[model samples]
Target: MPAPLLSLTWTDHVTGRQGFLVVDRLVRGVCSGGLRMRPGCTLDEVTGLARGMTMKEALHYDPSARYVPLGGAKGGIDCDPRSPEAYGVLVRYLRAMRPYVEHYWTTGEDLGLNQDLVDKAAREAGLVSTIQAVHPLLEDETEARARLADAFAVRVDGLGLDELVGGCGVAEAVLAALDRAGHAHAGARVAVQGLGTMGGATARFLARAGLTVVAVADVRGTIANPAGLDVEALLAARDAHGGVDRAALRPGDRELPGEAWLSTEAEILVPAAVSYAIDEVNQQRITARWIAEAANMPVLPEAENLLAARGVTVLPDVVVNSGTNAWWWWTLFGDIGADPDEAFAHIRRSMRALVERTLGRAAADGTTPRAAAHALVADRLPEIADRFGWYATPRKDAP
Candidate 1:
């Protein structure tokens, strides 16, 4: 069952503004979550996220797992930033939330929001960066996502790969897996879905690493090249918005149904799209020897089990998709604040270590990568919890 709701409150100010924060779960002193701005946001989701943050903190960071109290909390302003009068309403909402702005509920980008916009709201509310005016006790989601995306973009792009950071990391992991299993990247056929930051990154990375990116897709459409798509040409022709312009495409590449990209004949398939994108219904279409998840929960538990039964080696999401966020924290909270280059290096190191170790453990036990990761977390959480006094320590009997 989902965790129980730990705390909930709603506030209606004299200014006719509705503001509230839900500390759905609290482990210690830390709470982490996203700030959302959209319509019809209810208190339930915020509370749920708050709880998730606590658990996420508990799982992700062993050091803070005890003292951090990293509860998950989310704030939502039931307003659309796209609307003409959205900024004014957001300002009003922020003003009303001044009490929680700088400290209690550190806001970050979620649906219908971005860091720039979050900063706008922060500015109006007189909240500075954690180190600027006041050291923030909690981190915001926008910064986290930006940090991840930034790390992904800089390293992937600088390395001259078309893959987004998401893709590159997965590409690296896939290569690592293959090498361990005695398969090689050169002349490998790869199919990628989503073509978003993560997807594009993966495709580009694979292509450069000597994999034939035979198929790629986006929400708009798909293109297939059985003889290996010219990723560089396609990338060059891609529009500013990140979609390949078909009008500029060469004849070898032809458009296919978006879903068709997921089923193409390739040695590896990277799903960098939404969760549950691949279910039992479409799992049969999977042709890749390996399935790599570069999106959060892209593979359902059932689907994962099914893939495991089929002997299709799988690399779980957390192993591949955490590079960006890792660097973000290292930069913001580490004793040595990171510059851009150092940040990317930090992320790459974490990704390499996590993926390599998880893969090694999984291989030895003949277990799924996801299972190995959970085991890793499970092994670490208790020590953290103990150190933080989440449970009582036993007293020694006097001699």
Candidate 2:
């Protein structure tokens, strides 16, 4: 049996305190993951994420026929970050598991913790802090690492991390789908649901890409403007928690049911808000030929099947959002620069490649984009699992 590419280790130092490290694929390139904090999160989940990261990096680095092994890894802390004491405790927990912080086990931000939290935790754990207030050159490196970490953290702290990835990944996938359909981003009408980090980022990116963002929705309500909503203006009006000031929206903006954005007449619909936002009930009302899953599990599997049957191509989350997190992992322990633009560029390339590959697979299989993309990962899973003996015999299902 092949040894596992992914391994899980846990340490118990402080009483009632525990931490886990999951090592995914061991790419000759670089392997990276995040430290997540959540209530009731199990070790199994962390390991699964590590494995996913491995596949993500593999698919991203080489989406073609060749399966180049790219290392992937992740870690998680079971705790809440809302309290100051919990924050300190979280740091101590990370410190206890510092031995795993390496090129193979490099960690970044995940659910429940932000970049600030990771930086502080790393500091407490005695891992060389990314911050360098002393050396000028070191400071540049520190700034770059911090921004990359911050991007991953904010995705979790502000909007649910999974949701953000799903939203943005789907947005990119939608753009690819539109291109396949011969539709253009320039002057295309768009509506976004769920205006958190993922939704907000998608809306901003689409607008920047020259799409006419006509509407956006959050948990609070929906805001629409047929003349194209002002992305920057709306962003400026957002509260500390990213809530938009409905009163500050443009004159034509009017409040409607939170789910109303799904039915808008826009040519592109981005459900960046929440899971099941485009379920069976409202699936038929979706007027946009292009629908992106900005939130994880946004469409029920059955619903997704239905959408594919009806000709709407859905982009899967695992493939699309993998870039930002993947880039964060690579740059954190490597020679990444401090400038945010440079960091963003590194991630965009990975994202663009995955999108192109997924689209190509869809064209070849005559299936939904998600299936084609997932198949790429699924097809490789066996060789990987065989190499690790994960599926030896009756599927041990070992933890």
**Which candidate leads the pack in lDDT?**
2
Q: How well is each residue in 1-399 modelled by candidate 2, as lDDT tens digits?
A: 123455565544553645677665554323567677755556766776676666666575433313234456667666554544567667676666655463235565555555665787687778774222111222245556565455444433244332344334445666666776788788899888766556677787678778899888875888998888988788767763357988787778778888788788888777754445677767888777777765444677777888778777666656755655554444544434434455455555556677788888888998787678768877775665555334122212225
- Give the count of colliding residue pairs in each prediction: 16, 7
- Per-model lDDT: 0.61, 0.62
Off by over 4 Å in 1: 1-28, 33-101, 104-114, 117-167, 232-242, 335-341, 388-399
Predicted candidate 1 versus true structure: per-residue lDDT over 198-312, tens digit per residue: 6666777678788898888865788898999887676666643357778766788889998897789888888875556788778878878888877555677787788789888
TM-score of each: 0.71, 0.69
* Model 2: per-residue Cα lDDT at residue 102: 31
Considering summed lDDT, which 10 consecutive residues are worst modelled in model 1? Answer: 129-138
lDDT value for model 2: 0.62
Q: Would you list the clashing residue pairs of candidate 2? A: 25-71, 27-71, 95-125, 144-338, 166-294, 167-294, 194-273
